[model samples]
Target: MDQQMFCFQCEQTAGCAGCTGKKGVCGKSEKTARLQDELTGALIGLARATNGGTLYTDDTWKIFIEGLFTTVTNVNFHDDTIRELMGRVHEDKEKLAPMCSGCGAPCGKTGDYDLSRLWHADEDIRSLKSLILFGIRGMAAYAYHAMVLGYTDEELNRFFCKALFAVGEDWSMEELLPIVMEVGKYNLACMELLDQANTETFGAPVPTEVPLTVEKGPFIVISGHDLLDLKLLLEQTEGKGINVYTHGEMLPAHGYPELKKYPHLKGNFGTAWQNQKKEFAGIPAPVLFTTNCLMPPAGSYADRVFTTEVVSYPEIVHIGSDKDFTPVIEKALALGGYTEDQPFAGINGGRTVTTGFGHDAVLGLADRIVEAVKAGDIRHFFLVGGCDGARPGRNYYTEFVKQTPEDAVVLTLACGKYRFNDLDLGTIGGLPRLMDIGQCNDAFSAIKIATALADAFGCGVNELPLSMVLSWYEQKAVCILLTLLYLGITDIRLGPTLPAFISPNVLSYLVEHYHIAPVSTPEEDLKALLHEGE
Candidate 1:
C-alpha cells in the first residue's frame, strides 16, 4: 500500500505504524506533515553548512528552535503556519550556504534534504535521527518558553544546531550515541534556563492549593506554557469584574506568589491535556493557549479557544506580538459565566489539588526525606509522571500511583498528574505522598531533586532508591527522557506504547544499555520496581 504521508513522531500515529494516510490521529493532514518534514530537512541543511565553523549566531538558533517546536504534536495545527515556517527555514539556509545557489558542480552539501530519504533510510539510522529530531522538538518548547521570559543560553542554542546537523549526517551508533547523550546534556541546560527565567521572574513557587470551583462572573481560562500571557490576561482583567482560571499546564502558575496574588485568579478548570476537547465544550469564558498539548478544538467550544504565544488554531483569536490580550478580556465579559459561584472538583472528587511544590520546597525537607529512607519508613521513591493522553493503557499511571507502597513517596510533575493527583495519599514522614513539582518544564526540578538525593546518599542517581516510571504522548517528554538517559539515570519504565518512530534495534539498544522497559500491569510493574529497590 502506498503511504499517504509521514508522521510517526508522536505516541498516537495513524495506524501504529505511522501516519501514512490522509490525516494523523491528532488530525494533522498529510500535506501539513510533509511540510513539517521539509522545514526539519532545511534545518538539517543549515546545521550541515555550519560544520566546523563559528558561523552560528543567535538568529540561527532561534530558527532551529522554532522549527523544531512547530513540529511538536498539537502545537502548530495550521498548514499555513508550517508553510510560513518552511519559508523562513529556507531563507535562513540560503544565508548560511549562498554557494549552493547556482553551482553546477554538485557539492552534495548545502541544499535542503529530501525527507523521503529519511523516511526510507535504514530503520536504525532513521530511529536515531528521529530521536535527535523529536528530542529537540521537545527541548525547543522549553527553549521557547524560556526565551519568552528574556532568558537565553549560548551553549544550549549552539547545541541545537549541532544536533540538527547530526540528524542529516551519515552517523552510526558509535558516533550518534554521544550526540544522543549530548541532546540530554543540552536539554538540561535548556530546562535550567527556563527554570531560572520562571523562578527569577515569578519568584520561587511555594505549595499552593488551586480550587476547582468557578466563581460565577466574567472569567478567562489560560492554558499553555506562557506565564507572560497569563500575567497580561490578569492585568487586563483586573478590576474589570473578570476572573481568571488556570487550565492544564497553567495550573502551576497558581503557585507563584506574583500570580496567585490576583484576587480574581480563581482555580484550575480541567484535568489532563487530553480532556481539553470535551472539558472545554460550552465553556462560557475564553480559553487562551500559551503553548503545546493543544488538541484540535471541538466545534462546540472552538469560539472560546484563543491562542497566544506560539499556539495557533485556525479561526481562533490570536493575541499577537503586542500581547495586549484585550480580545480575551472582552470574551470573558461577553460570556458573563454562571449566575452564581459554580463549585467544581477534580477527577478524584477533591475540591482542589496542591501544586508548586518545586525543588526548593522538596529539597528544603531533604533531611526528613533522607532520614525516612534510612529508617526504612520510606521504602521507595516513584517519579510517576509525564504527559497524559487519552490512550486506554494510560491508566497505568493512575494505577501505578494507586498501587505504590504506603511507605513510598510519589514525586510528580507535568499535566500527567491530573490522572490521580487529587487522591489524598497522605504523607510519609514529613513529606506528602504526592508532591507536585511545578509544570512539565519543571521536570528540571525532579532532576534536581534526584541529583540532590543521590549526593546526600553518596551514590549515583541510578544507585539511589528512586525509580522513574514515565508516560509520554508528545515531543517534550522525548527531550526529558533523553535528558534522563543523558544523566545515566537508568531503569526507567516508559509507556503507554514506545514511540512508533523507534525501530526495533534502537529499542533493543535502550533496553540493553539503559534497562529501559515498557510498562506492564501496574501490579506487575510495582512488584518489579520493589524487587529492584531491594
Candidate 2:
C-alpha cells in the first residue's frame, strides 16, 4: 500500500516505528499529518527566503516558532488551521522576498522544501537531521511560552532560522552532527529563557500542596503548560463563582505565589494528559487545552473541549489572539460543577500532590541536602521524570519509582510524575523523598539541583549518585534529553521505547559516548542503575 502519512516524532508512534497509516497513534488523521508536514515545509521555505538576506524580525520569529510548535504531536489537528499557518508562513516569505515570486526561472532556492527527500534519505543523515528538526520543534515550545511573557532572545530566534535552514540543506552526517548537538546547546538556553519568564512573571515557585477534590459549583479545568492562560482564567473567573483546577502540565502552577494567591484556583483535576480521555469524560466542568498533549476528545466530552493558542481541533471553540477566555468561562458556568465537593485522588491513591521544587526552592535546601548526603542519610538520587503516555510499558516509571530504596530521593517533573506522584514515600531527613520539580521546562531546575549537589561534593554531575530514568512521549522530552546530553550528564535510562526516528548508527554513537540506554524492566534496570552487581 502507498504511504498516506509518515510521523515518528513522538514516542508512541505506531509500533516503535513511523506512523504511516490513515491515522496516527495520537489520533492525528493522515490529512492532518500531511498538512503539518506542509506547514513545516513552508516554515523551512520561509527560513530559506529569510536566509537570502532578509533578517528575522520579531514577526518572522513569532511565525516561525508558532509554525514549528503547531506541528508538534497533539498540538493542532485541524487541517484548516494548519493550512492557515502555512498561508501565513508563505505570506511572510513573499513579503521578505517579493521579487522571487515573480521570477520565471526561480532556481528553487527559496521554494518550500519537499520533506519526502529528508524522510527517504540515508538513515544516518535522516537521523542526525531528525535530531535537529525535532529538537528545535521542542525548543520552539519553550521559546513560544517565553515570548508570550515578553521574553525574547535574539540568539535563540536566530538559531531557529539557522536550524530550519539546515534541515532543507543536503548536509552530510559530519556537517549535520554539529547542528544536532547545537540544538541541545540552544535548547538549554531556551529552557532557561522560559524558566526566567515563568519564575519572574509568576514569582519563584514555593513548595505547595494541591488537592485532588473538585469544589462544588461551576469550575474550569485548564490543561497543558500555559500558566498565562491559567492566570487569565483565574482573573476572569474570580468573582464569577467558578473554580479553576489545573490538569496535566498546569498542575505545577499552584506552586507559583502569584497563581496560588487566587482563591478560586482550587486544585488539580486529573492525573496526567494520558488519562484525560477517561477523567474528563464525566467531569462537570469544561476543559481548556492551552497547548500540546491534546488527545482528540472522546465523544462524551467533545463539546466541553476548548483550545487556545496553537492548540486547535475542528469545530472546537478556540480562544483566539485576544486571550479572552470568555467562552471557556461561560462553558464552565453552564456546566455547573459538582453539587458537592467531589474528591479525587492521584494514581497512587493520595488525595494531594506537592509541586514547586524549582531551582530556587531546591537550592534553598542545599545546606540540609548536602549535610544529609555527607552524613550518609541520603544514599542516592533519582531524577525519574519526563512525559507520560497511554502505552502499556509506561507502567515502568511507576514501578521504578515504587522500587526506589528508602534512603534514596526521587526528583520528578513533567506529566510523567502522574505515574506515582501520589505515593507516600515519606521523608528523607527534613525533605520529602519524592520532590516535584515543576514542569518539563523546569528540567533546568533539575540540572541546577544536580549540579549544585555535585559542586558541594567536589565531583562532576555524572560522578554524583544521580541517574535520570525518563519516559518520553513527545518533542519537549526530546529537547530535554538533548539538554541533558549537552551538559555531559550520562547513564540516563530513557523509555518506554526508544525513538523510532533514531537510526542505529546514531543510537550507537549516543550509547558509546553518553551511555544512553533504553529502559528495561524496573527490577533489572534499577539493579544496574544502583550498581548492585557491578
Candidate 3:
C-alpha cells in the first residue's frame, strides 16, 4: 500500500513507522507535515546556493531558523501556519535562485530537491539525512531563543545552511561522518551564542532552590522554552496580585537572578512537559506556552491554554508579536488560586531541588571535584539526564539514578532531572550527589564541565570517569545527542525509546562505532556499567 504523507521528525511517530495518512500523534496533519518537509527542502536548496559563493543576508538566516523551528515537536500544530511558512521558504528560495529563471536546459543544480527523495532513500542515507534534519531542527530552537535576546552569530547561521545542504547531497558514511561532527561543532557555537545571550541579558543564574508549592491567590503558570515570554509575564504581572510560576522547561528561570528578583514570581508548579494534562487540570491558573512541547489541549483545560512566540494550537489564546500578555494575566486573576498556600512536592516527595549549577558553577568547583576524584572519594560521575516524556519505559531513569553507587555523583539537567531530582541522594565530598544543571539547552554546561574535567586530568573526555545515560523526547535532545557524538564521546546509553525515525541499518552503525546502547532494565545496565568500571 502506498504511504500517505508524513513528517515524522520526532521520537513518537504513528505506529513506530512514520506519521502517515492524516493526523500525527501530536495532531499535526499529513498535509502540514509534507509542507514542513517542503519548507525544509527549500531551505536546503537555498543553503546549497549560498554555498556556491552567493552571500546570504541576515534575513536569510532568520528564515532558515524559523523554518526549522516550525517543524519541531508540538511547536506548530496548525496547518495554516505550516502552509504559510512553506510559502515563505519558497519565496526565499526564489530570491536566492533568481538567476536560474526559465533556464531551458533543466539545470537541476539550482532548484529545490524534493524531500521525499530523502524519505525514500537507502536506510543509511535516510538515517544521515534524518540526523542532519533533526540536528538543525534542534539547533533552530536554541537559535530562536538567542535571537529573541538580540544575539545572533553569523558563523552559526552559515553552518545551518551548510549542514542542511549536506543532507540533500549523495554523501556516504565516510563523507557524511565529518559533517555529522560539524553539526556538533556548529551546535557548540550555537549553544555558546545562546548561553552568552541568556547570561548577558538575564545575568548569570545562581544556585537557587525553588519550591513546587502554589501559594494562595491569583497566579499565572508559564511553560515552554522562551525566556522572553516569561520575562514579559513577570513584567506585566508585576505588583498585580497575580503570581507567576514556572512549568516545564521554564523551571530553570528560577535560577536566573533577574527572574528570581520578581517578588511575585513564585515557584515551579509541576513536573516535566509530558505531565501538563494531569498537572494543569483544574489548576485554576492560566498556563502560557512560549514555545514548543505544547500538546493538544484536553477539553477540560482548553480554555486555560495561551500560546505565544512560535508555539500555536487552534483556538488557544495567542499572545502575538506585540508580546502583550494581558489575556494570560486576566485568566490568572479570574481563576483565583487556593484560599491557602497549597504546598506541592516533587515526584519523589521532596519540597525543593537545587538548580543553577551550570558549567560555570561546576567548573568553579573543579579543584574540589578533582581532589575528591584523586582521593578516591568520588569514584565516578554519571550524567543521567535528557528530555522527559510520557512513555511507559521512562522509569528506567528513576531506577538508573536510584541504582547508582554512593561513590558516584549524578549530574542532571533539563526536565529529565524531574525523574530523580527530588530523590535525596546524600552529599559526596561535601557536594550534593544530585546536581541540577539548569535546562536542556544548558546541555552546553555539561559539555563544558566534561571538557574541563578531562583537561584537568589530562585525558580524553571518554577516558574520564564520566558516563552519559540520556533520555530523549524531542529535537532539542536530538541536537544534544549529535553534539556528544561529534565530540567522539562514546558509550552513551539512550532511552526510553529509540527514535522510530532511525532505521535499523543506521541504528546498527551507531551501535557498532559509537557503542551507543539502548536502556535495558536498570539493574542489568547498572551491573554492566559497574563491571566496566571495575
Candidate 4:
C-alpha cells in the first residue's frame, strides 16, 4: 500500500482530522506511523489469543503493555524498534495458541486484525474504538511504570486484553461505547496502582522549592516521568562531575525522598514538551527521555537526545534494559555546559517554580481549607491542569489562571501548568493560591485531595465549590477525562477544542449528561464557574 499515514490519535492532528503526509504534526514520519499501525495490529492478535480459555502468562502482560504503550503519540519513533515489538507480540500469540500459526489447518480465531479496518470503519464506531485504543495507550504508560516497581493488578491486565480484543471485533457503536468508558474505569484503577507504587517506592512527595537556574559546568537534562530511571541516573552520576536537571514531567522527582537525596539534582530545564524543538536547540547538554511526550529532535540537537525504556527515535542512542547511562554521562561531560551560570525563567518570567504538593501535603490542610471556606476567605478551587501542546489557542489556561479570584486556589499538574505555574498567585488561607501537583497520573492525588475536602465539608464532590478547567493534548488526558466522567463528576470545561475523534452524538451525550462545555474566554468561563451555583 502506497499511502501516507492517517493518525489523529492526538490533539495536534493535522486539520483536526488525521496526519496525512510525510510527517505528523508531532514530527512522526510516514514510516514510523505505519510501524505503529502494524504494532497495534499485532497487539490485537496477541489480545485475541488470550480469548475464552488461553493461559495468560506474565510475559504476555509485559508484551501487551510494550505493544500498546509504544504507539502512544510520542513514545516511540523508530521503525526497527516498533517492528521488533510487533514480532514479539506475534511470537507470544503463536506460543499461546500454536494452532493459529503454521498449522496445516490454521484457525482464524487468533489472527491479527488489520488496523486500517479501524481507520476505515464507520465514523461513530471508529470514534468509540479510538477512545478505547488511545486511552489504553496512555494507561499502559502508567502501568509500565508501576510494573517496573513490582506493582501489577490482575483485573487491570485482563481488562487490557478485553479492550484490545474489542478493538479487533466488528462491534457496533452500542457495544464499543461502553468498553470505551470501561477503559476510563480501569484506567482509574491503573493510576491508583501507579500512585501506590510510586509513593511506596519513593516516599510521599513534599513541598520543595526548585530553582530555574542552570549552574555552571556539565549537566544532563532528564525528561519524562520514570522516577526509577531518574534515581538510577542520579546515583550513577553522583560524584561523577555531571549535574542533573529534570525537564517536563520529571520535574516532580525533586519531591521524592529517594531522589531529592541527591545534591546534584539541580532545578528544571525548559517549559513543556511542545517547546523542546526550540528549547533543546544548540543546547550544550544531553537530554534523556524516560516516558511519554517526546517530540522528535532537530538536527541541531539530535545527537544530544537519548531515549531509554520504550521511548525511541530512529537513530538516537537508546539506553536499554541495562540502564547504564554511561553514554549520556559521557555526552554531558563532552558538552562542557555553560561556562557561567545561566539564568532561566518560565514563560511568565518567574525565576523559580515549586512542586511536591502531593495529596498528603494538600490534605494535611483540609481542616484549614474547610474553615477558610466557612469564613469566606477562600471562595473557590480550580483544577486548571492537563497536557500542553503547540496549538495556537492554549493560552486560555494562562489567561484563566491569571484571572482567577484572589481568594481561590488553583491546583495544577502535568505540563499544562508550565503556562502559568511560574506566575505568582500568592496565598489563600495560608496555602499558596497556586499548588503544583505531580505528573498527570498524579491526578489520583488531586482526586484524593478533592474527596477529602468534600468529606470535611460534609458534601458530595460536585456540591463543593470546585471547578475543573482542563486542557487536553494526548491519550493520558483522555483516560483521565473518562475517569472523571465515570465518577459522575459534572460540569467540566474542556478546551482549546474538543477531541476531533469524538463524534457529534457522543459529544452531545457528554454535554447533556455531564454538562460538559467547551471553554470560552477566561473572563466568561471564570464568572460562570464561580458564580453559577450561587
Candidate 5:
C-alpha cells in the first residue's frame, strides 16, 4: 500500500498501527499530518539552535509550546493554520541563528530536521525517541497553561529544547533511555508548576456539585483544560444574562472557588471529548475548545464551534492571543439557548456529577482517611483515569470502576472520569467513594495524596494499597504515564491498549523494571488487585 503519511501518537490509530491513509483516525488530513511533521522538525531545529542553552526569552518558549501542542491528537486539523505556524517556527529558528550561511563560526549546526528519519530509523531508537517527543508535547501543554498565569519554570523551558534536540541526535537506547525517563521527571515538575498556578489563581477546588442540565437562556460550553479562560469568560458574561457551562476536561473548573463564585457559571453540557459530536448535536449553544482532544466538528453545530490557543479547525472562529472571548459570547447570545431547563444525564443516566475533590479537599480530611484505611472502612484505592477516546476497549475502565469493591475508592482525573463519574458508589466514612481530582495536570494532587498516605503509613507508594489503572490516548497521558514510572510506582495497569510506539525491548524493560501490565478483564483485574493488596 502506498501511504501518504504515518501517525500513531493516539489510541485510535487505524488498525493498531500508524494512520496511513488520506486521513488519520481522528480525522486529521494527510496534508495536516505532513505539516505537523514539518512543524515538529522546525521546533527541533529551533531547539538545536539553542545548543542546549537556557537563556532564551518567554517568547521563544511560547512559540515552542504552541508548536508542540499544535501536533497533539485532535488539537489542530487545519493544514493551512499548521503551515502558517510552521512559518512562525522557521522565523524563531532564524532569530536563534540569523546567519548560518555566512557566520564566522561555521558550525553547520542549526538547521530544520526532517522527522521522517526518526520514523524510518531503528525500532528501539524510534521507540525511545517517540516516547521523549510525545512526553514533552504533553508537558508543554501543562507548562503553557501555567505560563499564561505568570508562572514559568526556567528548567522546564530549557528541558523542552534539550529533549527536542535529543530527538534529532544520533543517540543509542542507553543514551536516549535516560532522556526518556527525565522527560517523566520534568513532566512531574511541569504538572506541579501548573497545579500551583491553577490553585493560586482559582482558589483551590472545593467539592461542588455540577449539574448536568442546561439551564434556560443562552450558554457557552467551555471545553478543554483552561481555567484562566473560564475565569475571564465568567467575568465578561457576568451580567450579560448568558450562562457558561463546562464540558470535557473543563468540567472540573466548576469546583474552583473563584470560578464557582460566579452565579452565572452554570453546569456542564456534555460527556468526554469523544462524545462531543453526539452530545453537542443541535444543542442551542456555542462551544469553545481551548486545547487538545478536539474532534472535528460535524456540520450541524460546526458553525458554533470556536477555538482558542493552539487549537483550531477550518472555518471555526479563531480567538487570538488577546484572549478576548467576545466572538464566543456573541455566538452564544445569538443562539438564544433553551427557554427551560433541559435535563441531560450521563451515559449511566445519572443527572448530576460531582467534582472539586482536589488535593486540598482530600488532604484536608487526611486524618479521617488514614483512620478509615486503618479501620478497614477503605480497603483499597484505585485511580482509574486518563484521556478518553472512542476505542471499544475503553469500556474496560467503566466496567472496572463499576466492579470495584465498595470498600475501595476511585480517584479519577482528566476526561476519563466521565466514564463512571456519575455512578454513585456511596461513601466510605464521610468521604465520597469517587473523588474527582482536577485536570490531568492535577495528577500532582493524586501524587501528593498518595505520598502523604505512604508517609503516614511509613511505606513507599508502591507498598500502599493503591493501584493506578490508567487509560492513555494522547501525549498528555504519555507524560503522566512517564511520571508514574519515574516515581518508581509499580504494578500500574494500563489500557485500552499499549502504545504502538513501545518496542518489544522497551516493553520488556518496563515490565521487568516496573512490573507494568496491560489491563485484563475488569473482574479478574479487580479481584487480583484486591487480593494482592491483602
Candidate 6:
C-alpha cells in the first residue's frame, strides 16, 4: 500500500503502528496531517529564531504553545486554520530574525526544519525524539490552559523552547534522552501551575455529584479541559434561560466552587469524547469544544458543532477571541433542547457520577486513609485513569474496576473514568471506593496524594501498596506516564497497546529499568499486584 503520510502518536494508530493512509483513524485527512507537520516545522523554526538572541515575549510564548497544541491529535482538522497558524509562526520568526530574510545567502539557523527528515530518521532516534516531541506537545496543552487563566511560569515557558530546539537538532540518543526526561521534569511544573490556576481561580474543588439528566430547556454542551471557557460560558448564559452542561473532561468543572455556583451550569451531558458522534446526533443544543478529544463531526450534528480555542474543524462556527458565545446561546435557544427531561446514564447505567477528588480533598482524608490501611480496613489502592478511546480492549478498564475488591479504593481522573464511574462501588473507611482526581492535568494531584501518603506511612511511593493500571490514548497520557517514570515510580501497567512510536530497544530499556508492562487481564494482573510483596 502506498503511504500518504505517517503518524503514530496515539495508542490506536493503525495496526498498533503508524497511520499511513489517506485518513488517520481519528478521521484527519492526509492534507491535514501535512499541514500539522508544516506547523510543527514552523514552530521549530520560530524556536530557533527566538533562541538566536531574540527576546521571548508573552506573545511569543503564546504562539509557540498554540502551534504545538494545534497539532495534537483530534484538536484542529482544518487545513486553512493550520496554515494560518503556520503563517503566524512564520511572521513571528520574521520579526525575531528580520535580517535573515534579506540576507543574500541565508543560513539554515533560523530556517524552518523539514519534518520529513525527523519522520524518516533511524528507529531508535525517532522513538527518543518522539518521546521529547509528544511529551512537549502534551505539556503544551497544560501550559496553554494555565496561560489562559492568567498564570505563567517562566521556567515552563523556557523549557518549551528548549524542548523544541532539541527536536530539530542532530543529537544522539544519549543527548536526546536527557531532554526527554527533562520534558517530564518540566511537565510536572506545568501541571502544578495549571492546578494552582484552576484551584485559585475557581476555588478548591469539592467532591460534587453531577447528574446525567439534561433538563427540559434550552442548553449548551461544553467539552474539553478548559475551565476558563466553561466559566465564561456559564457567566454569559446565567439568567438567560439557557442551561450549560459539561461533557468529557469538563465533568470535573462541576466540582469547582465558582462554576458550581451557577445554578444553570446543570449536569454532565454525555460520557467520554469518543462517544460524541453517536451521543451528539440530533441533539438540540449546540456543542462547544475548547480542546482536544474532538472527533470529526457526523452530519447530523455538524451544524450544531462550535469550536473555540485551538480546537477547530472545517466549516464549523468558531467563537473567536472576543469569547462571545452568542452564537452558541442563540443556537441553544433555537433548538429548544428536549421536550421532556432526558434521562442519560453513565456506561454502567447509573444516573450520576462524582468528581473533584483533587489532592486537597484526598489529603484531607489522608490520616483516615492511613489509619484504615494500618487497621486492615483498606486492602489496596489503584490509580486507574487516562484518556478514553473507541478501542476494543478498553473493556479491560471497565472489568478491572468491576473486579476490584471491596476493600480496595479506586482513584481515577481524565476521561477514562466514564468506563465504570457510575457503578455503585460503595464506600471503604468513609471514602467512596471510587475517587475522581479531576482532569488529566490533575495527575499532579494524584502525585501529591501519593507523596503525602508515603510520608505518613514512612516509605517510598513504590513501597506503598498502590498499583497504577493506566489506559493511554493520546499524547497527554504520554507526558503523564513520563512524569511517573521521572518520579522513579515503577511497576505501572499500561495497555490497550503500547505506543506505536516506541522502538523495541526503547521498550526493553523501559522494561529493564522501570518494570513497566503491558496489561494482561483483570484477574491475572490483580493477583500479581495484590500479592507482589507477600
Q: What is the C-alpha lDDT of each candidate?
A: 0.85, 0.90, 0.84, 0.89, 0.88, 0.90
Tens digits of lDDT, candidate 5, 1-534 = 246588989888888778889899999998889889989998888887777855355478888888888888889998888888888877766777777634545353556788898999899999999999999999989998998899998888889999999999998899999999999999999999999999898888899988998899999998998888888889989899999999998988888888888999889888999999988898999998988779999999999999998898999999988889888889999999998999999988999999988889998999999999999899999998998888898888999999898899999998888889999889988789999987787899999999988998999999999999999899999999999899999999998889998999999999999999999999889878887556
User: TM-score for every candidate vs. truth?
Assistant: 0.96, 0.98, 0.95, 0.97, 0.97, 0.98
Off by over 4 Å in 2: 52-54, 104-108
275-372 per-residue lDDT for model 6 (tens digits): 99999996899999999889999988999999999999989999999999999999999999998999999999999999989998899998899999
How far is 196's C-alpha from truth in model 5 (Å)?
0.6
**lDDT by residue for model 3 over 467-507, one digit each (tens)?**
88999878888889888888888999998878877878778
Report the candidate with higher lDDT, 2 versus 6.
6
Greater-TM-score candidate between 5 and 6: 6
Candidate 3, position 11, lDDT: 67
Give lDDT for model 6: 0.90
Query: Top lDDT: which candidate number?
Result: 6
2 or 3, greater by lDDT? 2
Q: In model 1, which regions exceed 4 Å deviation? A: 1-4, 56-58, 532-534
Tens digits of per-residue lDDT, candidate 4, 1-534, equal 236588988898899877889999988998889888888888887887888325676599999887888888889888888888888887778778887776544344546778888888888888899889999998998899999999998889988889988998888888997898898799989999999999999999998998999999999999998999999999899998889999999998889888888999999998999899899996799999998788878899999999999999888999999999999999999999999999999999999999999999888878888888999999999999999998999999999999998989999999999999899998875789999998797989998898889888888899999999999999899989999988889999998988988888888888999999999999999989988556
Pairs that clash in candidate 3: none
Note the clash tally of each candidate. Answer: 0, 0, 0, 0, 0, 0
1-534 in candidate 2: lDDT tens per residue?
148599999998888888999999999998888888888888888888887435655479999899999988889999998888888888888888787777766555457888888889999999988989999999999999999999999888888989988998888899998888899999999988999999999999999999999889999999999999889888888899988899999988999999999999899998888888999899988999999789889999999999999999998999998989888888888989999999899897899999999999999999999999889999899999999998898888999999999999999999999999999999988789999997897888888889888889999999998888999989989898988888898889999999999999999999999999999999998899889987
Error of 1 at 148 (Å): 1.4
> Using lDDT as the measure, what is the rank order of every candidate, best first?
6, 2, 4, 5, 1, 3
lDDT of 1 at 339: 89
Error of 3 at 44 (Å): 2.7
Candidate 3 lDDT (Cα, 0 to 1): 0.84
Q: What C-alpha root-mean-square deviation, in Å, does candidate 1 show against the real structure?
A: 1.8
